[model samples]
Target: MSGSGNVHLRQMARQDVAAGMELVQAAGWNQTEADWNRFLDANSEGCFVAEAESTVCGTAATIIYGHQLAWIGMVLVHPDMRGRGIGTRLLRSAVEYLESRGPLVIKLDATPQGRPVYQRLGFEPEYEIERWKLTATPSLHSAPGAIPLDDDKPDIEDVIALDAEAFGASRSALLHSVHRDAPEFTAAISAEGRLLGYTFGRHGLHADHLGPWVAEDQEIARRLLETFLDRSTGRCLIVDCVKAHPFAATLLGSAGFEFSRPLTRMVRRAVQSGRRSGLVCAILGPEFG
Candidate 1:
């Protein structure tokens, strides 16, 4: 356990899921109880919670991708606890934990309010990301070559490989978790029997979130996105898109997706290699990426 003054930090447990959900809901975040569970299930020892006077007041979670990369997310502080140093402490705890594990890179998608705190922790801006939303069904034509991949299908491995190439790290575990939760939202595009792109989605509290959307080019990205949108007709959808990607803005705009907010993709320490930024149209989510 770690603490400063009245604020105490400890490893988040399964029992703390409800408390975590309360913080998420209070922040108007899209995460559900299941999302909280996913973090604990992924890395029980790496997730942390803060307490003040014995009440949980803040939380932070981390997911390490085989020492290549680690993600810090779900950092939250209760409204009443905002002015204290709880958030910083929680972030520090997460960073320290991830650093101990020897990942080459640590990353987080920072809200404007959290950017400065992250900057102070030695995180440098990587790129701008935007959350785009579609409230109504998009008028999308069928993506003829795109095919759906069920969680149990043999093709799922191909999807994982394609994703690893684009994301620069292997996130097969998270991808499997997403597929387990929303298999209907998983799709891929292939040409000449080779995987070109893949996309995954998860059910959010208020919308269907599509992402980690990767492709070889704009046309492939569009096809994957169109497949997702076509399947998610009449439902609210969200995509956290990389601003620098060539196809994101145009595709999202044409599909009637309006920009919601900006998130900065920040990285701690230097990025060595293998990040195919051009291939990644949207990330899984700010919390997961």
Candidate 2:
């Protein structure tokens, strides 16, 4: 356990779910209980919480993908706990735990407030991703060419292969979790019955986030997005788009998704692979990145 003053850090337990959710919600983040479950489900030992006076005050989570890379996110400290060294302790705990597991690279998408802290910890900038939001669903005048993925009988290999090339890591299990949780939003755009592209997302309490969104071209990307938005109508939607891709900017901008904030993808002991901008329009989210 790590602590300073009254705040102390310890391995997060199943009973901490409600308190953990309160920390993230207080930060006005998009994560839900399901998101927290993703981390705990991935590795219960990898998540941590900070507490003071028997109350949770901060949290951090880590998820490793196929022993290749690990991502740290949902790093939060209650407003009352900021500047008390609680965030640092939680972040350090996450890094140390993952380092013990020996992933090639450790990464996280940092907000402006957290970028300097991560840089201080030796995380170098990799790329910029912007959170784009669509207040209202995009108009679906033309029928989408893509079809909803048959959740019961999906071509797992095809979906995994396409995502692996675009995402730079084989997160077949993560994709399976996303699809199983929200299969209605999982879709594919094909031509001549050949897989052109695919997309998957999860519903949050405040909004629905579309991510790990990949495509063969802009048209396929467009169709897949429309299908997701149509199902996600009446709810706030968010997509974290890579700034390097002009097509993503144009497509989202044209669809009325305004830029909200920027997240810098940072890595420690950086790896050369893992960025395929032409095919990857949006990422799975900072937590899963």
Candidate 3:
């Protein structure tokens, strides 16, 4: 019911799914209609989409976590609408709605272009990071001392609990979502049965993306990552590592992992209490913000 020069911002409706997803791909975020629909369907509280002249112009979603935190999502702008303030308006609406509801502010990872806009809106840079992915052989065989987390029903909940403690965020749903029926992903533990580390990922159409690779230490982290590559064999194995972490540069560099993409985990004031580098893989996902 809103329009501005053919541009309108409002909550996304059930009918908006297909067109909204088409717009998502056109915005160059590398997501699909199915992905967009699933995201919106899961988000009952809401999603924000902007339409221009009855066509999809932009879309973003907010997934509220326990009424105390909300994660921003899929902020896309039409290719033709670049620099027209469509995205800014969509993002602003999301933040404003969240702030008014009082959810300790919000957080999101931004692409280079998205970074500047968020910065202008008071979002702060979180330790200069990049989402690095590589698909070689699975690291399972090559990484020394690498043992699968699920070998004997490895306590997924325990690993998730450790992750929540390290990242200082409520991620049970996230852990459940990523680990459910996804075998390409993996978790690593020490010989002494200590909760060492893990990598969450899935096989996508183009490539397999492993994110949120967290660990107890550099050695364990290296083993977990190396295991992924070794297990991949002829297949492509992917991982997203944070530059801010202590051994990310060294380990990835040693493994010949190149920086193919750059993204930022942008944050605004009334900040949520969590350390992205402490026990993070890739800030969960850039698209999830």
Candidate 4:
């Protein structure tokens, strides 16, 4: 444990999931209990929580993708405990723990309120991403070439390969976990059994999020999104899309998803090369990114 006063930091455990959810919920975040589970499952040793008088007051978790990179997320503190250094302490602990695994680069999507803190910690902007939402499902037409990716179809290895190319990190484990968790919303575009593009969805507390969405062309991207929207009708939906993508803004707007907020994708060290940002229409989520 590390802290002063009544606050102390410790490794998070499965039993702490509910308390973690409270912190996220108190912040009006879209994360669900399942999201909390993903963090703990991804790296239990990297998930840390701050407790004040034995109550969870803050949290910070990290997910390492091989030795090349690590993602810092869920750096949330209870509203009643803001400005008490709890958030900073939790973040520092997370970074320190992740650093112990070696000098892997750390990245996160920063909110306007949290960007300065990250900047002071040596993070620099990589690119901008935006959260778009659809409150009411729009009228849709089926795109000609889109196909359903069911449990029995689409080679998982191929999906991971494309995702790695687009995301610049091999997150096969994360992608597989997402498919296992919510396979109903998965779809792909293919020609002669060769994968061309794909998308996966997640069920969240606030809404259903569509992402890790990648495509080789605008039409494929549109079809993948259309498939998700058709299946996700009537539910609150969200997409954290790359602002620089040529088709992201237009596709979202045409589908009735309006701009919600802007997020800055920041890296702790210098930005690495090979990130195919253009092919990534939408990210899995800010937390995952």
Residue 87 of model 2 has an lDDT of: 81
Model 1 lDDT tens row, 1-289: 2334678899999988888888988888888887888888888999999987787899999987766888999999887778577889999999999888874689999999889889989999988999998886575735464445433354988888878778888888888988998887888767668877888998888888999898888887777787787677456889999998877888999988999999999999887478777888999999988
- Output the worst ten-in-a-row residue range by lDDT, candidate 2: 145-154
Indicate the worst ten consecutive residues by lDDT in candidate 3: 132-141
Candidate 1 regions with alpha-carbon error over 4 angstroms: 1-5, 141-154
TM-score of each: 0.92, 0.92, 0.84, 0.94
List, residue by residue over 60-131, the lDDT tens digit for candidate 2: 999887767888998998887787777888899999999999755888999998898888888999999999
Clashes of each: 0, 0, 20, 0
Q: Compute the lDDT for candidate 2.
A: 0.83
C-alpha local distance difference test of each model: 0.85, 0.83, 0.67, 0.84
Report how far off residue 38 is in candidate 2 (Å): 0.9
lDDT of 4 by residue, 1-289 (tens): 2344778899999999899888878877888787778888888999999888888888998998866889999999888778778878888888888889997889999998788878878889999999998886565535443355563377878888888888888888888888888887777777887788889899888888999888888888888888887677458899999999999889989988999999999998767778777789999988989
Off by over 4 Å in 4: 1-4, 141-152
> With candidate 4 superimposed using the best TM-score fit, by how many Å does residue 114's alpha carbon deviate from the native?
1.3
Best by TM-score: 4
Tens-digit lDDT string for candidate 3 (17-95): 7777667556544454545555665664468888777777788787656556666778888777778888889889888
**lDDT of model 1, residue 111:** 94
Comparison by TM-score, 2 against 4, better one: 4
